[model samples]
Target: MKGPLFYAKILLFGEYGIIKDSKGLAIPYNTYQGALKKSKNLSEVSKKSNENLKKYFDYLVGLETTLVTFRLVEFKKDIEEGMYFDSSIPQGYGVGSSGALVASIYDKYADDKITVLENLTRDKLLKLKQIFSKMESFFHGKSSGLDPLNSYLSLPILINSKDNLEATGIPSQKEGKGAVFLLDSEIIGETEPMVTIFMNKMKNEGFRKMIDEDFAKYTDACIDDFLHGNMKSLFGNVKHLSKVVLDNFKPMIPTAFHKVWQKGIDSNDYYLKLCGSGGGGYILGFTENFEKTKKILKDYKLELVYRF
Candidate 1:
């Protein structure tokens, strides 16, 4: 048995800032995805995935909640029958790998699960977020639940603030020179440790102030600019946002990419920011000219995300 596909997601803006009630924008990234499938004969990879699912199933059974309930009996039966997640979404890349898994499980087993076709009122969206938060917390030590929310809906989500988000339309992609892209950091990131560092940093009043004032302001601006198709303003805000991340969120930035991150801000070729938690994984890049940015960073791998 195989279920439908669940795609990956990218948080275009508001990475850590969102933890502090800042606005964020997340869009579905269809380039990579995953789905649940069952096989008559399990291969090594599938066997490993199935084993992991067994553990996850055990975890879910212990979760205390009133939001959504899973069919643990059926889910366990399926796992024993070779049910496993067949996916291409890269784990530890901050591209919502576990999120897709959580989404697939909920889609297949949750009682009265919210379908993407529903009207998706504010209350429903929040409920889904709460449910996803609990499910995904099995992976991340703590979660905002946006990743699975984006994957489940397969639509752009505009986060106004904590507890205030809705599916919203983004500006149509255009074949313009300006673009949003991902740069492969070539290093895997663990979300739990990175989040721990951020939490520890939060003990500082200065860090808290920076997040509330600088980081959130630029993130909100970038989201507004992108939605409004205001490229001129978007680039300007992205520059500031990139600089702020580089200067304050230094620990999250991989040591190897510090110079490259600065180079983009210095040359105006592109602006680099954390894609997700950002100890490694893929770093999000913004450039006015994709070709020129590609030329400048020829040695590194680049993937185009959205054109503006």
Candidate 2:
């Protein structure tokens, strides 16, 4: 049986800043998506996934009124019958493998939960985020719920501030040298440790100022410029944003990629930023000229998403 769809998401800008209520933007990446499916035959991966999901369901069921209310008996029966996610989305790729599952479970099982079909207002969105956060906490010790929220809505989400957000439309990609692409890190990044590093860094006033003054500025500019179809200004801001990631998010960058990251910044061929939590998975890159940028970084693999 085919269940609902859960699309992948890309946090174009405002990773950490959004947590503090800074402006941010997240767009659905349709290239990678997942949906729930039932199968009599299960692969090892499917078996493992189903087993883990059972545990997650048990945890949610145990929470009862304290967390979200779900049809636990129905869910347990499904789990027992080997209901699982048959998906192509890669796990531990920082692209929300667990999120898709969480979203699908909520869609199929939650009792009196927010419906994606209804006109989802800001209030409903917040409530859904809260529920997803609790549900997803089973995987990551903590969760922003953005992954499942985006997957569930399959819309471009805009973060105006910490508490304010809405689905938005962004300019479609154009055929040009300028494009956004992902470079796989070939390793999985655990969210908890990476988040810990960020929190520890936040203790310093200096880092806080830099995030508000520098990081947030360029990020906001990039989002505004991209949405407005202002290529010139978008790349200009992307360059600064790339540099900011290089400087402040050093630990998140794959060590082997340090040179390539610096190479892009120094040569202006391309600029790289974290795709998800950064430690590993795909690294996002922006370049004004794809042909030129490709030639410079020809040795490393490349995947182009847009052109300009």
Candidate 3:
């Protein structure tokens, strides 16, 4: 049986900055999504997914927590019968592929599961984040859990900080000259290693200060501007944020795009920033004029996410 579809998510603002308590905004990307289903004759890809689920089942069973529990009996039965997550959300692209899978499994098997219909209070939302943090950690090695949280709720989430995030209503997309788009890098990114690099960079006092001052400031401003529909301020702040990421988070930016990233900032046609963890996935882009930007970057595959 097929279950409900869980959508991919875009961390519009606050990529690495969120780890340091910077304000962040995430929105559901409906272009790609995932759901659970079973097949008697497992295809090669389905077979791989089923085998992965088996391992995930073991992890959940062994997890010691009162926060949430799953119906292991039924889950195991499904796993044995060739259940797999059929999804189009590309992994390592930073668009929450695993997050959708985690959400789907939790939706179907978790006892006392939090439903999207309920009044999701601040405490309840945090609880969901905490529970998701635990469950999704199996995939990311370490997870802030925002990915799964966004996928599960199918709502835009605004992060005031690590402890203070909530389902937020973003201004409806206006058909205008401005837009946000995704530029596919066509390379797989490993979250664990990228994270390790960031953690190691944190040990440097200089990096820490820059993150606290420059990164956090621009990130918060961008989030505020985005929510308020302040296109002018949003573009300015995003330009700063994009520059900061380019200058400092160089390692995270895939090597091939260094020239391309800088070219945008130079030309003012578009500004590019990390879509997720960088190092290869989707690079987030912003342009004041989509028509011009479209012609400017015709060599690339540009996917429209939101119109401003």
Count of steric clashes across candidates, in order: 0, 4, 1
Candidate 3 — which residues are off by over 4 angstroms? Answer: none
- Candidate whose lDDT is highest: 1
Q: Rate the local accuracy (lDDT) of all candidates.
A: 0.94, 0.82, 0.93
**Tens-place lDDT digits, model 3, residues 1-308:** 88899999999999988888888999999999999999999999999999999999999989988999889999999999889999999999999999999999889999999999999998889999999999999998999999999999999999898889889999998889999999988899988899999999999999999999999999989989889888898889988988999999999999989999999999889999999898888999999999999998899889999998
Candidate 3 local distance difference test against the native: 0.93
TM-scores for candidates 1 onward, in order: 0.99, 0.95, 0.99
lDDT of 2: 0.82
lDDT per residue, candidate 2, 1-308, as tens digits?
A: 78877877778787777776788788777777877766778889889878887888779867645546788888888877777887767776677777888889898988787776899899888888888888888888988888898888888888888577788888876665678877777888877888889989989999988998999899899889887889888878988988988899999888999989998888888889887777888788888888887788777777766666
Order of models, best lDDT first? 1, 3, 2
- For candidate 1, give the lDDT of residue 79: 93
| Preferred candidate (TM-score higher): 2 or 3 | 3
Overall local distance difference test of candidate 1: 0.94
On the 0 to 100 scale, the lDDT of residue 148 in model 2 is 91
TM-score for candidate 3, please give it. Answer: 0.99
